[model samples]
Target chain A: MRFSIQQPALLHMLQVVSKAVAVRTPKQVLTGILLEADDNTLTTTAYDLELGIQDTIHSDDTNQLDVSTPGSIVLPARYLSEVIRKLPSDNVSISVNNNYMTSIQCGQVEFHLHGIDAEEFPKLPEFQSDTQIQLQSELLNDFIRSTTFAASNSEVRPILTGTHIQYTDGTLNFTATDGLRLATRSTTFDDADTHNWTAIIPSKSLSELSRLLPDNDTVIDVQLTDSHSLFVIGETYFYTRLIDGTYPDTSRIIPKVQRTEIRVNVKSIASAIDRAALIARDRDNHMVRLEVQGQKMTFSSSSPEIGNVSESVEASQKEGDDFQIAFNAKYVLDALAVFDNTDVLIRFNGSNQPFTIQQVDGDVGLQLISPVLMR
Target chain B: MRFSIQQPALLHMLQVVSKAVAVRTPKQVLTGILLEADDNTLTTTAYDLELGIQDTIHSDDTNQLDVSTPGSIVLPARYLSEVIRKLPSDNVSISVNNNYMTSIQCGQVEFHLHGIDAEEFPKLPEFQSDTQIQLQSELLNDFIRSTTFAASNSEVRPILTGTHIQYTDGTLNFTATDGLRLATRSTTFDDADTHNWTAIIPSKSLSELSRLLPDNDTVIDVQLTDSHSLFVIGETYFYTRLIDGTYPDTSRIIPKVQRTEIRVNVKSIASAIDRAALIARDRDNHMVRLEVQGQKMTFSSSSPEIGNVSESVEASQKEGDDFQIAFNAKYVLDALAVFDNTDVLIRFNGSNQPFTIQQVDGDVGLQLISPVLMR
Candidate 1:
């Protein structure tokens, strides 16, 4: 392929697709990025079996890209990234010979890179699906952030490593759990069709998708298939394989009754827990205890070797009987991070039952943490 | 000990002294910082056998510090740093009980930290030294930066891990080498005594000292003894033990006669070498070659598996004969980084002999690099 493009534009496109390049696989072609130039568009593709990313840049009125010949080549992603980053000029020209030997030139610098034929690269999976949904990029990002952290990091139960996403009526719900802790978020979209569906997507895929999404109100088109899902944002396409097992029913795990409830400032409690964590983190479970009495809430943690820490924060509102609970400090911190609101409402059934936390005035997000038995 | 100090001031003092705290030493007290409260000043000290650092904060007009009782105790550096960093108030109160159980209070949060008697901590080494020299902190920082990178990281030759500093006739010279490359910097101080002395300070100590030095032209008092060197910067005292070995003489290795000399823009050659290094770093030695013909200089590097790269930069002046030399690209990059001047003059004895690089107009810094024999 023979083409000349603005260095910045090419670099941006390469960065977007390179995330899918395999790091250390037996197949050499999996480590390369496929480049194809046809007509006025240049497309870059990278696939690592589990995930595939493709982006295209077109030659328009700005003349940022100029194609002299239509062809394809696969170049090693690591070296190509380093070369592009160190190129000295604004415009770069690249050409591939019959032997797949590529020459990249910019001003006084030139590099000859050995490339594999594009045919050797794996083809991205394509599926036929009639179900398509449109959602704002910012809302999808929020859903992913609120639930993904609660997903299981271990592979003991592969299904728990994926977030359960479902659509019913005009509302979308995302839920993730690791047995000990659970997080869920829901949002309503009036424009979505009434057709309902559910999918279990790996948390890693959702995280990567969140990073690629723009922070604006641009609409993203999502196509769901039985085995694969595709997300189209502008000229980029991100695809990931769906987890193959049924997700657990977490609805019964969330406590329905509360014996105690307290509303406190998010920053005050977060800081208090953070300080307590400094002592609690030395233990295996990272346990911190929270006690609610009247209008005051106290957080305390101690390690046999590191002494103890205690801090009290005044709750803005309290109701019902007072109670105490001990749970992982990291779980509460993660749950608190997803809320932009200043105040959070926490409800407890008992010291041993799972407690739920949510925004003081909205039902958009909810998180539940199971208490750990304290000695 | 009972004291109330501004959180920022205590944090700053802890950070400065914490650099000397032992990471994984057998002596438990080495991991703790010794805190001493006198009438009006609170002192913090940390020592790890090889290095000791002490800093004092006084209760001045701003009343940043208040000492109510005079006592001393040693507290673990890691936990104390974390607690002070997370304190919620500007002013923090610390008190040590008769049993050395310390209570730290700030705002509504309180921590009870276990502390050891100050007598258990290793005492700072005492030395008799009347030879004192005063130099600007900025100049000492410059000397450290220009020479420290060339120090050997390997322990094969322990002497090479230290920088040889010599003072004679009002001039201070700093030099370091790792067998393959050598860097030297010299500066003059008019106020220094004519009495001559030399010391080999570990590169690690110089690096830490450089970080603590202020950027302004504040005078620093340096006292050199037989076995230790103490630098007093304002209220901080930094003590480091000298390396117990004889340093090799590097004067004979720098080539005196040259057959080829070239003057080139530092940025142009440095950027070319940096780009070439992208290809060269995959090899064992990180080799990059430079060929000077007339006024054009070319840099090239190749790996058997990763292809090759070539770039040309124009030299402003050339003398004697055209030549080609190969050396470690990282060595040249590190040497070039010490020079802020745009132009540098490089003198070459031959293709195989060591070449020297220096500022085009000044004699303050000089670097010598040995070329590798190519296949």
Candidate 2:
């Protein structure tokens, strides 16, 4: 294979597909990226058995690409990336010899890298489906960010480590729960088809796709099957295998009735809890307690070995009954971070039950956290 | 002790002394910072047995320090620093109870921290010498930066892990070597006394002192005794124990004749070597060869498992016979970093002898590296 491509364009495509390169895979060939240059285009692909990515860069009127011969080769991802980053010119010329050794020349510097035969690389699994869903890249990225953090990271419960997605009534919904905390985020999509489907995607795959999403409001096509899912954005095709299991029913866990409701500025309460949490670090649960009475709210935590710390912040309004509850400081902080509004409403059913946190005026994004029992 | 101090001022003093606090010491009290608030001054001190630092902040015309009672107490350095960083007010109020428990209050937030008795803290050693040296903080910092990288980090040769300092004939000199490479930097101080002395300061201490030095050119007092060296700047007093041993005679190791000398642009050569070094990482010595013939220089490195890489750059001038030499790329890169001149002159005796790297115009700073033997 012989080809000359622009450095920036090639670098971007390499970065997009490089995420699928396995760190330490049983198959040694999976550590390299397959590159094929044919008919005024270069295609790059990487697969690690569970996840695969393929991106194509076409040489058109605006870009310059010259291909004298069409062939394929697999080069080590790390070495190729580092060499491209250190090249001295704007354009890179690469050619492969009969022995499968590739020569890369740019300005005054040249590198010869040993490459594996492209035929030895495993082929990417084919994904097909009759129903396709359309989503704005920004909105899909937002849904992943809001719910994925609540997913369990342990391998004991494999189903809980994936984000559950469903389509109903022209709305796309996402939910994730770790048995202790549940988060749900949804957005209306009028362009979605009438066919309803559900798939549990590993949280790790969704995060990587979110990072590769473009910064504009372009619409992308998504296809979900029983065994895999595919996301098509421009010339890039990202695919990940579906986690085969049933997610627990989390709708029954959200609180229905509240005995007390308090509205406080998000920044004010978050900072107050942060200070109290410092003293609570030496404790068993890292718990911080909140007491709401009249127009005042006080946050405090203590350790018998050290000492106690307390601070008070003003509450906008309070209803129902005055109450005190203890909670894991990190859970409360994580729930408070998703809201863009200045104030958030936290509802409590009792001192020992689960509570709900959401935006002060909207119910679209809701988070439920189970309170800790104080001794 | 009861006093109110500005938050930034207190934080600065705490950060300076905290560096001397031991992480895990047999003397548990050494982990706490001793605090003494007198009529118009607040003093903070920390000692790790080998190193001690004391800084004083006086309530003079420009700074405000209020002391209602004169007393002293010791508080855990880490906890105190963290609490002071998270306080909510601009001024911090601190008071000690009869039982030595300390209360810290800032605005609406308050913390009670456990404290140790101040009487158990170790006292700093006093150094009194008639001969004193004055150095500009910037100049001293430059000297430390140029030589410290050559110090050996192994404990087997403890003497090579320290920088040798000598004051003779109105000039101060510094030298450090790790057997493979040597670096020396010096400056002439016209006000120096006739008394001559030599001492080896641990590289760790010089690094810490360099960090505390002011950015501007401020004159600081320095005193060296048989056991310790003291550096006094403004209100801060820093002391470090001297390393006791005999340093090797490195002067004889430098070659006296040059068979070939080449001058090349520093940036061009450094970047070329950096690129070549990437391919040389798999080798045992990480060796890169420089072949200088006439006006052109070529840098190349290769491994049998990985392929080869080569690059060429122009040299301004070359004298004597053409030569090819191999050396550790990292050592050559490090020596090139200390020169401010656009071009550096490299002098070589032969392919097997040591080479010297320095600015083309001056001899005050010099670095020598021994070449690697090729098969």
Best by DockQ: 1
**lDDT winner:** 1
**For candidate 2 chain B, which ten residues in a row score worst on lDDT?**
B187-196
User: B325, model 2: CA deviation in Å?
Assistant: 2.4
Q: Which candidate is the best by TM-score?
A: 1
lDDT of 2: 0.86
The deviation in Å at residue B13 for candidate 2 is 2.5
**What would the per-residue lDDT of candidate 2 be over residues B13-87, giving only the tens digit for each residue?**
899998899899777789999999999999999989788889999985444678888889999898888888877
lDDT of each: 0.90, 0.86
Backbone clashes in model 1, listed as residue pairs: none
lDDT of 1 at B228: 88
- What is the DockQ of the complex in model 1? 0.88
